[model samples]
Target: MGVFSTTSRYSLAFLVMMNLCLKAMASESDIDFSFKNFGKVEPHLALYGDAEVNNHSSSIQISGSTNFSAGRLIFRKPINLVGANPRTMVSFSTYFAFSISGENGDGLAFVVLPVEFPLNIFDGGSMGLLRDRKIKFLAVELDTYMDKTYNDVNNNHVGLDIETPVSVKVGNLSSVNLVLNNGEKLQCWIDYEASGKRIEVRVSKFGETKPVDPLLFYYPLDLSQMWGDEKNGVFVGFVSSNGNSSQKISIHSWSFKSRMPPPRWMHSEPLDPDNVVEIKGEEGIRSIPKRSDCTSRVVLALVFGAGCGVIVAFFIVFVWIVVGSKRPVAPEELAGKGNEFEYKKFGEERAIKDGDGNGEK
Candidate 1:
């Protein structure tokens, strides 16, 4: 009974250790998600203002026919900045296909804001990004109508704005003869290199690669400073608006990729697994380091110990079964069996001697 109790305890411990190992392994793996087609509204995206998923056209319509309508679509998860320093920037790349129709007044923009749920700014010429001037954000605006009040270059142009309506850098979309409100699909690529502190923006007709010379190239665009969050993370999304004239802005497809650094709590040595892992928006598989956290190391030790314990328990049970099967018989039964064996041996010897005597005679 005591042996059985010990074995049972070891078995229970082994199961518990294995469970912990599995949980730790699951936690160490990074999360990667993608949505090829927005047949329905994605759970990871939050639609505020006038944004709605249009299944009929397989797109996200930001604004419809209503005047003074403003829309914002935000990614629910906040992207982690690379490091603690103000200059540490996170690298990102995104490709999107969009179209705008009707009387395009205010236009649309791709925004990176510090707050997950940001307040709606002014409508019309502000393009839904005019606030109390305290909001820290950046944007790439595709202006389809000229706003003289905002110092817009022309009706067709792309501008990079830093926390205000007036852009620090502007590029004429007419240089490539690209039309925004013509109901034609347009493709745009935005790439940010944190190491070089460079941003490249490309726009072209649908189904075409980025031009050799990007439409807009800016340097020293540090996103970490623009984010200005306690954790230094930022929310990315799109915003659009319509003034007195109404328009329809739709996003047919979008893909976002970024590299997320390790969390703050995991900054200690030995147990700290502070490795950069890239999260591809379309691809699923990526390699993760072995010692990503203290939990992983603990789980690994537990798994090894449990495996040894299981082997020892199995050996002990095998020895016990063998010893139990070879138990000695009763003494009286042994003596009786020995006597019958001696009597048979003597009779065989006597018969052999008689045969030898006969042969001699």
Candidate 2:
């Protein structure tokens, strides 16, 4: 809706934006632009209509026009959100945050695609307009119906299908934080409870007088909006459509960081000039490192491990002492019978008798 704040500072480490809500970001710096650092690129289609959300709430009215025609919203032209170079993309993705009530079709997708028209729509009839299309876009869908082919979290669930696969309404959402990636090949990160306000961290940057398209292109985009490297690009706006079926979806408020998570590397360390480790990939493809945001994680893990070891050792020592005490004491030599050692084995005898059940009287 409005520009994010400028006061906050974001390191190259990670893009830490404010939590999304109905409210706009305080300034431009707080809202992350995925490709801003690499180059100047603007989203061919970006909307903050009814809402703009993330892993949590994702539902909306898919239009400034014709969005309410049916129970579903559709897209005639695909919206592009580019991150890095398309050709070299090991994986590409885009996110659409919206919500759905009455399930006639599926919900939405975070797609990285190849074409423009003939966009995808729903198969199971929950997310209609934004459902199925036979194009080159990768459909990371949060499906809500049980299509015959493909996997499902339950009757209704979240799934990742390449360019409109068979009907796959995997799961439904009350408040879900779903994610799609290429590691397990495809996976959805859904959460039980919406994350409470952890910390009010922030970051931002200023805009330039120069055109912003080149920078926007650095981030990934959906196939529908992938037109090539052109100067003074065409119409740029969030696109949606509603077929015979109409559903409502919206983006609550989008707050992105310049240092957002990498495409396939969420848990890896940022590129550190001080210390860097480059791992080889399959073939000639280079692989990156794991995310090193373990500032608090490492400390917590060590503390817990040590605590458990201490508790275990204390228990073992306590048990050993108790068992040793209960063991019978050996009798010392009794010197009383004219320099002769008389056997005084009462404790030993009692222990043996008890062991043999001879002292049962």
Candidate 3:
């Protein structure tokens, strides 16, 4: 049939060039912004020191009372945290909406460092991080100062800073009556679950709802040892300080998201190896297909090549209907007629006359 319509038009132009090369390798350098109302800021955000932007209430103040103030706001790109496989790790979530008033003396974090770090190394109780020590971070703070030198679990807590500043899990905002420095507007959340290397934290009091537990939990955090793999990338914002008291710190609304870890055939449940916490040279936390794409392996290879071309066209129409039913021919072999041949009528007479002469024309 015109060579199967020229082999189905070269297999649909090779599946549209393999679906544009799997959408450019499952392209995803994800990071989403929301800022419901930071009015104008956003020049891809990367404010440093005393961060600003408060067009009459479209908040963002991040550290003001001054006494040795410091601030940051980050997000000038570096995202990717992990996905083109490199020992898989990539999952995130964030939300913000802060507020803290004066006299709290230090606190406010949520970092993830290493994107050439040094936005000017910080000081004063580590909220603005990097009091150097071979810098490496991954914070969450929100402290409010009680610093007995990093052992603070009092001035309204919620910690989890991993490359030091001491808190290896703290959370205790007066057990939930919530009071960070009392200026009101709270709300925080943080998630990260590259298949249960887990991490979760939550808080409330802004518009409420979104607190089904998790007031801090950290476990096996193998964020690929914090940016030393998957081709390095990491830099997600917010930091603050006001150490010797004079604290302000505002920051109204914010958002963040990241993903990549779903393809275990789209998992339908089975990740409870006792709530997975296997870390120690990590590996095997299964789930790989968030991005770095193959468009679901090219849509399952075009549905397995159209179901194997409809099972090879139904096995070539079942061998052409069993060779066209043995090509027809048996009505008693077309009514048996051939054997009556010797009907030499006109020849009979000539033969009789010429028989004796042994020849006849």
Candidate 4:
């Protein structure tokens, strides 16, 4: 009995240790955030500058200023840019919904920086990012206004910035012709593939599906080298700024996955049109339906209707033929001398009369 009890205790201890190790490894592999409401957010989220939680709408307003304001929201927990095994790097993807209103001056960016917690940065056109030679970071900027100093391609564009405000590459937002400060909400997707060291950014109107082509694509970025020898991880968050003309920048929803094409095990809510905010003066800018999908639907409807009509016509014709065959022959036509039935009856009566006459004789 003593031997059995000792073996059971050892087995239970081994199982507990294995469970703990598995959990730790899983947490390192992925990080997911769903900002449905502030109450549900993890305690690690640190809000800095003008950022605040709006309980009425359940969104985080990063910056709302007419003069000059800045805001930053950073996750306190550091994420490994490269996995535990140095040879394999960790890939990441993110989806977010945001809106800019009023006179849009500057813009907002999603950033991964090697800075410590409680970051206080510059405002205005800088987008609240710290500009220091020693600071290393990567940013995907959604710029709204043109800056001559940066050689901006257009007022509305997306850019990839590495270690400096000047973009290494930029893609013009040709689809958006209207002023972005019109209170229109937009959604964006960012994907980073570690193996290829490539990054892609896609944008679409809020509540619409993602576009097939990416607006910005940058390749050959060495994430491991970007982290530098001193750092093996970085903090992820958002930063926004406004200049003389300001706007209200808010994040309605956000999600992050630590793997490319996000695994099925991760749970995130799909975009819902009913939850999207209706913007005025946006009717003209609504997305048009795809030609192929519209054509297919119309063709299917016509084929189905034609098939039903043919079946109904055949049923009507069959019913008419059946009714005509059952109709009785008219009595006037049957009594005519040329009728076969009338002739047979007359012969039978004559034969019976002849028999009667012979008996009388």
> Which candidate's lDDT is highest?
3
Ranking of all candidate structures by their lDDT, best first: 3, 1, 4, 2
Error of 4 at 203 (Å): 0.6
Candidate 3 structure quality by residue, lDDT tens digits, 1-361 = 5445555565677679879886666557456677777877888787878888888989888777467788899878788878777777777899998988847767788888887778855655467766756768788988888889878879899898888888889989898888888788998989987766788999899997999998898777888876746365878888988777787888888889887766554444324444434344466455434433446558876887898899789657755554555554656864644443344655687778788677543
- Model 1 C-alpha lDDT per residue in residues 57-114, reported as the tens digit of each score: 8889887658887888787887765544555556678778899885766788998878
**Model 4 local distance difference test score:** 0.74
Top-TM-score candidate index? 4
TM for every model, in the order presented, reads 0.61, 0.31, 0.31, 0.62
Instruction: State each candidate's clash count.
Output: 0, 90, 2, 0
Q: Could you give candidate 2's per-residue lDDT for residues 1-361 as a string of tens digits? A: 0111211222211223223321232221122232211121124333332222233332234432243332222222332232234322112222222344343334444433444433333332323234444444334444444445544554334444434555222233322322211011122221111011011101111121322221111111222233334221222223332323344444332222222123222234234443434666667645443456344557667787898799789656755554554544445654355334225566667778788785565
| Model 1: residues with Cα > 4 Å off, grouped in runs | 1-34, 84-87, 116-125, 260-361
lDDT agreement of model 3 with the native: 0.77
lDDT of 2 at 244: 33
Model 4 spans > 4 angstroms off: 1-27, 39-42, 121-125, 176-179, 228-232, 260-361
Cα error, candidate 2, residue 319 (Å): 68
The true-versus-predicted C-alpha distance at residue 319 of model 1, in Å, is 39
Kindly provide the TM-score of model 2 when superposed on the true structure, using C-alpha atoms. 0.31
Report the lDDT tens digits of candidate 4 across residue range 261-332: 232223232333444444457465454435564575588778877987997886567555545445456578
User: Least accurate stretch of 10 residues (summed lDDT) in model 4?
Assistant: 260-269
